[model samples]
Target: MVDRKLFAGHAVRRMRRRAGLTQAAMAEALGVSASYLNLIERNQRPLTAGLMLRLAEVYDFDARTLSAGEPGGGADAIRRRLADPIFADLEIDRAELEEWLSGAPGGAEAFARAYDRGGAGTAASDAPDPGTVVRREIERWRNHFADLDTAAEGLADELRQQAGDLFGAMAERLRVKHQLSIRILPLEVLPDVRVRLDLHARQLQLSETLDPPSRVFALARQLALLEARGEIDALVRGGAFTDRAAERLYRRHLTGYYAAAVMMPYARFLRACEATGYDLELIRRRFGASAEQVAHRLTTLSRVGARGLPFLMLRTDRAGQVSKRFAGASGSPLVEGPGLCPLLDTFAVFQRPDERIVQLVELEDGSRWFTSSRCVGPAGGWSGAVRARFAVTLGLAAEAAGVLAAARGLDLTGGATPIGAGCRACTRADCPQRSAPPAGRTLLLNDRETGVSPFGFAGD
Candidate 1:
């Protein structure tokens, strides 16, 4: 419950409810305060070893499950329940939904059962897209988990002690531990597989198609997954994953986080970032990391005490679809939900894959920001490799843009574009890129004529 600690509060709450006991009764039975019991039920308080031992005596179940604490299996059922279009407009957190499901899983199931029985309105076409639901669940988090930081930092420190002073030493340490024989196969040999491990031969095969940073990254990622199993389990328990997909995403994310931390050990990375004025290329050279990796590592600078400038880093394709987004320390939601405005610099970088686009932009509310977008690339779309047009947009509030090395000569005298997070919820009706009118607004299509803009609103 305390970021990285292990406990399964869901199991306790479920068992107690099954026994048909009140909170006060359960609290007294557990020898804790009713409020404390509530915390335990909600997973806000950990089910300590002592508590697990006591629960064994109180109930006739093995206490070992509490060590890792079984995560409630209501994710899929609750997901099915939320699939009803009636819940479409609601911005519900899966964590909170999971809590509700755990506390009253029977009720949750009954509600879903009733909904399936046509309590929800007809027309399956009206249901939210399953893909959209998944994205929303992922977007609920700010994309940084502190527990990964703790785990990654611990792994990096251990490697640092063992490997001494060497760049990309984590990979070396893993090679020794796993008794791995590194092999770089032809691009055509393992076309889809970037990194493949053979348990029998202790051979690690990598596609030569990958660049240096990517190859190292794949190795480090594999190492993280293999070695950080316990940490990953704890992170997963703490992840509150609503489905297997979310859990998989979290695992990959954790592995990537650990990989980056190993590649750029926090202490050295932070100092280098400061010394280099946060120059991505310079730091990339100093540390064997890619531009995307460097940008991502920048966002994870949220470690306590030795923190760096909080920069919001987000990735998007030419279609304005968000792949990864971080809110930074300012707590300002730089971008929300999905469907970025076509006018944003991120999408624009797709045109000139060779160039990095930097601009000063103003929001509708008049807040200004300095943003830079660069294609994280295979240059010419490479035909066989990663897309060259996929760009990562990194930005900082105008007030805090000094952290950027390029901000020294950044011109702020220009006008900024009128942009919106997305078109459906966007209030701006005077744009040519308007695919549809704002959700609640009415078009001024009367007896007269249409306005100059593609989508015209009733109000000015």
Candidate 2:
């Protein structure tokens, strides 16, 4: 009889809200008194295992969320980062900052990005923004969502026990508890969609063209959403999103995380990562996930005590627009300051799609990074007629490169390309591809003297 002593209070409230239930309504669904649910939400009383399961059985929630713990994200993480003297004048609290983070994570991240770059404002358009803050919130304690991974693994176990029909098991759960019917539609009307839920019709529609892994993942995501809705909602509502667009964007991000986790259960996936030395192709084939998905999931493997390699992920388009980024690793993390470094092979791979490009990048301050960059075209079942394309770069600190299989045969020594966030902050005096002079630097020009570098700063 595990009491909800470990229950996430905010999460319970959020689940109730997402279900559009009153305290009385939610309590009734959970087979508990309205006062008891009220107490649970207020941390005045803990829910028993019976009530927890009842909530899940009724609402399709993953039970792991109940044990994930309390939410106080923005206050502590933001405070530590802002401890610098530059922001000593401002005072922020757990409740106040949490409210702000919930409502406008992008703005909060914009502030953190500016601070991380030691700048007055965000100079690079693609640098960490409020949207990033929203996504990073879940990523910060990614293991909390590892419960979804465990649930996925549980379903996998059930498949073995029931002899290989997890979808049937899941569909039966939907039908019995949720009164929902499942349909696999052809890619004609669903050409651009992945999963469509018709709550009014109590129907779930998925694309027939979805690969086996994707089809299972879509089913898992739907189940995870129903069972884990409270978990996702709690994380989303805790940020207190003021902007509807940012809220919806982050909600989708959280949902996709559940989908990926369900597809590649964390523990099972970690075993594969170790056996494969974090090789993207092998992991993709083994899990039936895409290379891009495998790469993105690599960044989320930082669960405590069960941590894997500290790999950070970044993706950018041909036009130099950074679409996705995660810098969860600690040591010399991928900084967010300037525009695209024209010299880094990360951008060049756009032309050489199939080629594997490895890089040794050194900053002006002498820290180094090891990275493998490759161009990945959009996968099938993406709504558009023409799938989009982007280059994904997986990188690690230079000292930590020893843990990665991709770093083999490469000179871990010198001859590294000296790069900066962009021309605005770059101090390199001799670069052929300087886009703009570094900020606060006076462009050096003498009538008789011409330097090879387009705009050599006076200091440089």
Candidate 3:
């Protein structure tokens, strides 16, 4: 049937297939019977407005494609379908529908899917924050990297002598076996450039857009992908990819870990970090990485036998916007999920440049962990746009405190602040910024007993 209404149905079918969901499952999510939802997909029924909003709310689907004419390449059939009873009295324009479809996939798909599923009168929900999405993506990669470490550890002896220069060795292997040329160019001339792997001439061109340190880093990344294909495959095969988009994200993430491993050379970096007592600045200078980069690399030292303490690394701007986070050995369960401890004065360190070190204790699930935080400035010209208060933090469990190199001087056990995940999830009843009560706590607002803390939760 040349039903214009079926256009959105087709999109839903495509997305559902990509998401690996069966029709009955999608129907349940839409609050409709499987047969009814199937009819809408088959263009037997017009999708109402309510159903559109529900789709957006549930699957995080784009809503723009709902009102667009018949889905797919059959434009003429869609136009005929649009002219049916559904649009006979309505003043809908096909051109407008096409324009909306071409631009807003997220909004459209949400609307059509929602309407087809019998959405209530509720309004569509807000799109999720991109920062949150990116953070979650990073956490997934961190786990994937851990797997790579395990595999590499098993292959250590076979690759021992070649470990330090594995990238170089891999590149040479590729060149000798595949007849490829590797060249590095300067950063100023090729800013934002990266390695280009050419299959035609079998050449891998490294971007000159980086310094000598970075040139070698990029080469190593290329070599990792080429030489360690089996390792990479093992890491990726465990993931359930719904679409080409997610697969592409996995590949890009893999390339990044490879690049980091190339520059840091896991074994060498770990030894240096141990010898130097984990000095952030010293490591940054030696590895030609930014302060944030250094902290990130430090957390990844858990490759094979040289596992670092499960340290949680976070970098935030003066405004408390977290730029990056890495979960080391501590495996702080909070790494992948939402909610941050607002009282964890990591952000304040940026306010005072000379005051390099500050410590606080956070209580998660009744267990206390000591966290050390500091702000570091960016290298290069002072006039650069980099913020002054870029804070980085390292935390160690109270019980496992002595193992850390830095925690050696501090008291093994001490009194500390009882912090919670962000203000909403925090049980601290005295916090002024507590907009919403915590998940399972009663806020007692006694004028005489109210403390200075923003939210004051009675101590258990």
Top candidate, metric lDDT: 2
Better structure of 1 and 3 per lDDT: 1
CA RMSD per model (angstroms): 8.6, 11.7, 16.9
lDDT of model 1, residue 291 = 86
Better of 1 and 3 by TM-score: 1
Question: What are the lDDT scores of the predictions, listed in order?
Answer: 0.65, 0.67, 0.56
- Give every collision pair in model 1: none
lDDT of 1 at 6: 37
TM-score of every candidate: 0.67, 0.68, 0.55
The true-versus-predicted C-alpha distance at residue 5 of model 2, in Å, is: 30
Model 1 lDDT tens row, 321-419: 786666544333455534677777787777787777888877665678788888886412135545545688887777777657877787664677777
Error of 1 at 355 (Å): 2.2
How many clashes does each candidate structure show, in the order listed?
0, 17, 39
- In model 3, which runs have C-alpha deviations exceeding 4 angstroms? 1-147, 150-213, 265-291, 301-306, 333-339, 352-358, 374-390, 432-460
Candidate 3 lDDT at 176 equals: 72
* Residue 34, model 2: Cα distance from true site in angstroms: 47
